[model samples]
Target: MIIAVIGAGYVGLITALCLAKIGKSVICFDMQTDKIESLKNGIAPFLEPGLPELLQEATNSGKVKFTSNINDLKDSSIAFVCVGTPNDPKTGSSDLSYLYSAIESLENVLSQSSTIVIKSTVPIGTGEDIYKKYPKKLSFASCPEFLREGSAIYDFMNPERIIIGTRNDQDKSRIIDIFGYFKDKAEFVHTNVTTAEMIKYAANSFLAMKVGFINEMARLCDSFDANIKDVSLGIGLDSRIGKAFLNPGPGFGGSCFPKDVKALSTTAQNHAKELPIINNILVSNQMHKEYLADFIVKIAQKYNQNNIGILGVTFKANTDDMRDSASLTILPMLKSKGLNAIIYDPAYTNSKPKELDNFNFVNNLQGVLDSTKIIVVLTEWSEFKGLNFNSDAIIIDFRNIYCISDMQKQNIKYYNLGRLNEGAN
Candidate 1:
């Protein structure tokens, strides 16, 4: 089967490469000529583990093709719309401009009875709207992607559930057949297009809420001189609470959680419904960012230092994505307070956050530590786990990468979230 994936960004590239790995011929379409050329050379535009190897193998086997032309999708029976739906700054809603452009570009090129899958995270009713605008012979399905940024390849191969949202039975059957490669790997859920769209928003918002709730608890733990790690362990053992998203960190910041939570809240407001929990989640997360920034400022004042070292800038470990990262907010807050920061990340390869255009970014971990007085671990990168700290240097760990007992044994002054007494050893 010939499958075409549009918008060769993270989701589009991963989807195209993974599908090709399953022995299906795939044509990946993108507007960026450079990105297409990079993919054709087996070079991924972003840093994702296991993707380059799979892409190279797929290209070498003649199973995958990358092109910037929309006409390249003419022979594809199934075209997945994996374009981005970034949050609109003005409306605080998901911007579907890219999605619309992708669809319009392929309007004349796609086969008469082709099946179009909406893999992008979008507002509800988008699939229905597309179905209404397109030809009746063309089938539309809302199969929202649930792949995590760092572990996208693994998630694609081993999804928990596969959702196929379409009104037509034939379309559903054909879509199922397309994903028949994963029949035993995942459970297939069939639903209407709108419901499928809502599922993505609902899942992301709920997960954001969980992260917010735990961060709130971490704050309380700090106040009460209690340990948050033990609390998380206790609650997570209940089976109902689950261990996922329970770890306390510098709030949730990624491509999905922040944008999806805001989009869901905005959607609720448009319907004349109030979502206090959702609204509070956003507020709490923002407050937590400020709180962490303030904590850094206080530490700098106590240590009589103006320079601070930041260990990681990416929102989370394993990916170089810095979208909405805590560093973006915290670093600006610190700068406003007349504090200097030297930042380093293992994944920092020429991709600096636009917000920190003038900020100092170091390529080596030792460079960040040698020039700064205090170390602040923002993203929990694996290399940071084996780091040797200076005994006199104060370490503020937002991700809780090190244990209090270990830091105390080394007589290292450390502060971590959900720990008591600000980690004074």
Candidate 2:
């Protein structure tokens, strides 16, 4: 099959590479010529584990290609619109200008009728709207991606469920054949386009709510002299609320959850419906970002040291994507209150942040740990577990990366979310 994925961002990049790996000829198109050139030379613009290797293999095998021209989709069997739907700067609603442009451009370039698949996380009824406006009678499906950043390739190869949102049986059969590369390893879910779009929002919003719920509980645990880790474990064991996304962190921020949740709320409001609880989850997550800064500030004052160190800066480990990262928000809050900070992320080298001036990016973890009086474990990178700590240094573990058994023997004051300490909660 000849598949054309529009937009070489994370979603489009992964989709193209994965499809190529599965013996399909894929052309990943992007707006930037530089990005296309980079991919042609087997260099990924962003950091994702296993993507560069797969890109090299696919490019060598002549199964995957990158292009800046939409005309390349002329002979394609499927054109997946994987472009980003960023939120408007003024309004929180989804900005569909980029999405509509891709659709119109592909419409002009398409030589024959083809099925259009939406891999982007868009609002409900967007597929129907596009179907109405399409120049030709092109079949459409809303097959949203549920792949996480660090584990996109693995998730793609082993998906939990493959959803095909088309009411027509013929359309569903075509979509199923496209997905048959996975064989019986992936389950199929048949639904309407609007319902499929809503599934993406509902799934992400529910995960966001789970994180917010735990963070709120952590706050109360701090006051009542309770350990939130134990509370989370006890609750998670109920079988109804499985233990995942329950661990408290600074907040949930990446390419998907934050934007999708807000977009969902905005979509609901447009229909004269209310999602007060989901709205609260989004607002509460912002507050959680501040908690990391507050914890670092208090630790700095306690140790009487103005220097602070950060372990990881990415939104999550294994991926070097920094969009909407909690560290971006927390680091500035610490620096504003008179604290010198140095950061070290395994996936990142020495790139100075444009907005933050008082921050220093170091090459090695030891370089960051040696100079600062307190170390903040921002993202739970696996290598951070090997850092040597000073007795006087304060440790603020946001992601609960440390081994609980070893923490008991350490002389440094360790403060973690959901884990109650000895003194006054």
Candidate 3:
């Protein structure tokens, strides 16, 4: 099958590469010329564990081609739309401008037998609306992607469920054919377009809630002088909780959870309905970020040190995605109170984000080690584990990557979430 994958962003590119890896001929298109050029040379603009290898294999096999021209995709029978629906921080609503653009662009080239599979996470009833808009020839199906950033390749190859949301069996079968080898990876959920759209939001919202719930409990643990790890283990062992997103940290931030939760809440508000839990997830998350900043600043001031050390900046480990990391908010807050940080993360050794131009970054772990005052571990990268540090340094392990006993043996004061930071008081 000649597969046309649209919008070559994180999800789209992964979709294209994976389809190519499955031995299907793919033509991936993106409006961004720079991105298209990079993909043509087998270089992924973003970081994923197994992407480079996959890109190399696909490129060598000549199964996938990247292009900026839309005409290159005209001959494909199946088109997967993987554009992003970025959420506005101020309005807490998703901007579907990119999705609309991709569809309009696809409409010009899509054939009568072509099935437009919508893989982007959109608001409910979007599939039906798009079908109505182009009812002449193109058939629509909502096949929302649930791929995680760091492990996108693995997740793509082994999804827990494959959702095909279309009222038409013909449309559903066409979407199913696109996942030829992956149909047995999990259950094939055939449902109406609305139900499939709601499933994506519901899954992300619930996961975000799990993250929020654990973080809130960590706060309570802090107040009561309790250990949150034990609490998490006990609560998570329950069959009901099942223990997936229960890890306590600064908070949850990524492409999916934050945006999807906000969109779901915003959708409720637009319909003049209320979702108390969904609405307050963002509020509570922001509050936690602020509280963490306050805690770090208060504790760091005792040493009267102006320079602090940061271990990670990306949202979480194994990928270079820094869309909404807690370190972005917390580090700036520390700066406002007169503290400078030297950061080192495995992801940003060669390149640095221009948005963080104000802060200083080092290319190696030893650079951050130069500052012995206080070291804040932000993202929980595996490289930061089991490392020796200066004996006089103070450690604030935000992601719980360090051992409290090891810190005590070295006579370094250690503070972790929910274990109680006596230094803050």
Clash number for every model?
0, 0, 0
Q: Candidate 1 lDDT, tens digit per residue, 139-171? A: 788898999989999999899999899989977
How close is every model to the real structure, measured as TM-score?
0.97, 0.95, 0.97
The residue-by-residue lDDT of candidate 2 on 105-144, one tens digit each, is 8888875557788989898999999988876867788999
Candidate 3 structure quality by residue, lDDT tens digits, 1-425: 69999988779988998988888899999999999999888788898998899889989999999999998888998889998899977777888889889999888887787888889999998888888877465888888899898889999999889988987888887777777688667889999889999999999999888898999998888888688888999998999988788888888887788889989999999999989999999888888988888888877777777788999998889989888777778888888988888989899998787657888889999888875578888888888999888888888888987878888899988988987556477
What does each candidate score in C-alpha RMSD?
Answer: 1.5, 1.8, 1.4
Q: Higher TM-score: candidate 2 or 3?
A: 3
Worst 10 residues of 1 by lDDT: 416-425
Candidate 3 TM-score to native: 0.97
Question: Judged by lDDT against the true structure, how good is candidate 3?
Answer: 0.87
Which lDDT values do the candidates have, in the order given? Answer: 0.88, 0.84, 0.87
In candidate 3 the C-alpha lDDT for residue 28 amounts to 93
